[model samples]
Target: MTKNISPPEALIYAMVTVSAADRAITTDELNRIGSIVRELPPFRAYTDDWLADAAQDCGKLLRKPHGVENVLDLVKATLTPELYETAYVLCAEVAASDLAVHHEEEKFLALLASNLEMDDLVCAALRRAARARHHQL
Candidate 1:
């Protein structure tokens, strides 16, 4: 079942998914996600407490079945096309944070793209760009 989630909430969820893809969350990944959350335009007015609350909400959802779908839908519905594209780029960044993408990570990113109604070609491009970026890091 789908749940109602705001754009910012969805972005946080996306962050959670990327962070958890390896079955282990790293400090660098967490810090990167925190930075991304803080830089988002929708989160501009968020206080520290508010950001913490959102992070908690995302943490809860991560434990649910098909939770990623719900978050991607929220983001797809709420963000403009350009923003969604940006978010996809951000997802790539998150995936690359660990210096390598696992199979699970690739699947998760593909699923995220599907959830957002992005074309397969676009998803492939995103993956390629992400891998390239990771290699550069």
Candidate 2:
């Protein structure tokens, strides 16, 4: 039986997948994801333990053929137009949390931006914000 994830869960899974894209999900990335869930208003009702289940579901989806595309489809369906930017921002934060956007992570973000019809300028701004937040200096 296939388990379906809710919109909020989808958002969390998306972040998890991006962090895992580089094949090395750093401690910083996981901590950032956890913080987002714990502190964000949108995720107030979501429990912390659900992160693992969502991540595992995302892994299963990605293992299938055209999994990335499939995941994008899920994202589009789960998120409303107004919330699209929120999704992009969340994904960007995860991608940049480690202070380094790996090639795979960058590719995933680009695809996510395209899928969500996010404006390039907006994406640039979001990326800048994410980088700034994680900047050590």
Candidate 3:
């Protein structure tokens, strides 16, 4: 098992995983992650420097055996049940920030939803919100 991580760190891992799901993390995605960390209420106590560190730590952990599963388990363990939806929404935001959700990103979201025991209807609503927020005319 990975070391016990803070809730903020767990959320960061979720975003990073979603960002990297497509194997090509885009500039838009990176900006979205940064913005989420800087603006989100959950991350209010988290510093900008810690954002980079947490993302790096998540990446290194992901290089290990069964990394994705391990990270998901860590996130599920670290966050309170109440924050599961928050975690999912944050990830969905990142995945949709570039105005496109790739196949890999969709897969990651499904895995995250399963790991967090999120309701399918809630996930659908969150995904729709993310898409609507990121949509441009």
Candidate 4:
């Protein structure tokens, strides 16, 4: 049976996965993530307290072992196909933000796509976009 999940929760899960991909979350990355989160339509009307709460929740989840899969599952179960695709693209953007995509990050991204049941073609497109973004940096 499928589990129920919320869009806001799914987004937060995606962000948390990206943040933990590199094994260490840098301040710059965290700030960038915060900026991205603030700009998300779902969070458009969100106050500072709401953002903080989400970030804290993400942090708490990250502290647990092997939580990425759980997060990915939650996101996949909640998001519609279009939203999942968009989230994958956003994840690529976040992964490429540091000007380099670490091996672990790439693997994490692949795992995320797999968990979300995204097609290989779509994943490839997202990966290409991420590479393009990295080159532009």
Candidate 5:
């Protein structure tokens, strides 16, 4: 049911990568990812099945040695400038989905910011927003 699949799939893959980086994927993380695809403006046109396909594709990529860098490069290449921060924010949201950022997730976030070459201020703001939004209080 994936239609017109393209670079945006990289976005989903990025989220999935974050979810699995700790060697475990939580229900909250999975729900947050699904909600992102279903309700986020950027994904309004994206298909449900595309999420599964993207996640699976990312799993395969991570099985390789340099898959993390490779997948991030694909994301940086595909996302428009406007969407660059959006991708970072989505990753941040997934990172915070479990109520705390794991060490592995922190490393992935740093790597993502480095690869995206995001503005330091923008990255800080997105990180705060994602944490605030997902806070378990």
Candidate 6:
């Protein structure tokens, strides 16, 4: 049976997926995810263990066969079409948080775009914005 996830949970999965894309979840990426949850309007209602719990659930899903595909499918189903770009942007934010987008992360980003049916130009713009935001001083 397919599992159902809330929009907020879907968003967290998106971030978590990107963070784990490189096979390691860095401190910087975790911190970025926390800040995004704490500051984003969609996550305003999420508090305390909500983030951790959602991340853990996502991790579980990631461990199963075809886990990544399951996650992308779940996320695509949970969120509305308008939120697809936001989901992509959130993933980009996490991927770029550590200041380096690994090869796996790049592949995941492309997959995310394709799964969500996001426009190429829009994905490019969001990716550029993520890189710019994380640019070092």
Go through the candidates in order and give the clash count of each. Answer: 0, 0, 0, 0, 0, 0
User: Model 2 — TM-score against the truth?
Assistant: 0.93
Model 3, total clashes: 0
What stretches of model 3 exceed 4 Å from their correct place? none
- State the lDDT of candidate 1 residue by residue for 1-137, as single tens digits: 35676676667767677767778877767777777777878678667676678767866776788666656666677677766666776777787777877787778787777767788887778777867866752
Per-residue lDDT tens digits of candidate 5, residues 1-137?
11233656878978988888898999999999999899987777778897887888788888888888878877777777788888888989998988979999888888888888888888889989999997665
**Candidate 4 Cα misplacement greater than 4 A, ranges:** 1-5, 134-137
Q: Is candidate 3 or candidate 6 better by lDDT?
A: 3
Residue pairs in collision within model 6: none
Candidate 6 ranges beyond 4 A from true positions: none
List lDDT for all candidates, in order: 0.72, 0.86, 0.94, 0.73, 0.83, 0.93
User: Per lDDT, what order, best first?
Assistant: 3, 6, 2, 5, 4, 1
- Top lDDT: which candidate number? 3
Expressed as tens digits, the lDDT of each residue in 85-124 for candidate 4 is: 8778777877777777788888888888888788999889
Off by over 4 Å in 2: 1-4
Encode model 2's per-residue lDDT on 65-123: one tens digit a residue: 88888888888888888888888899999998888899999999999999899899999
Candidate 3 Cα deviation (angstroms), residue 126: 0.4
What C-alpha lDDT does candidate 4 achieve relative to the native structure?
0.73
Q: Write the per-residue lDDT of candidate 6 for residues 23-114, one digit (tens) a residue.
A: 99999999999999999999999895999999999999999999999999999999999899989999999999999999999999999999
Checking candidate 5 for backbone clashes, the offending pairs are none
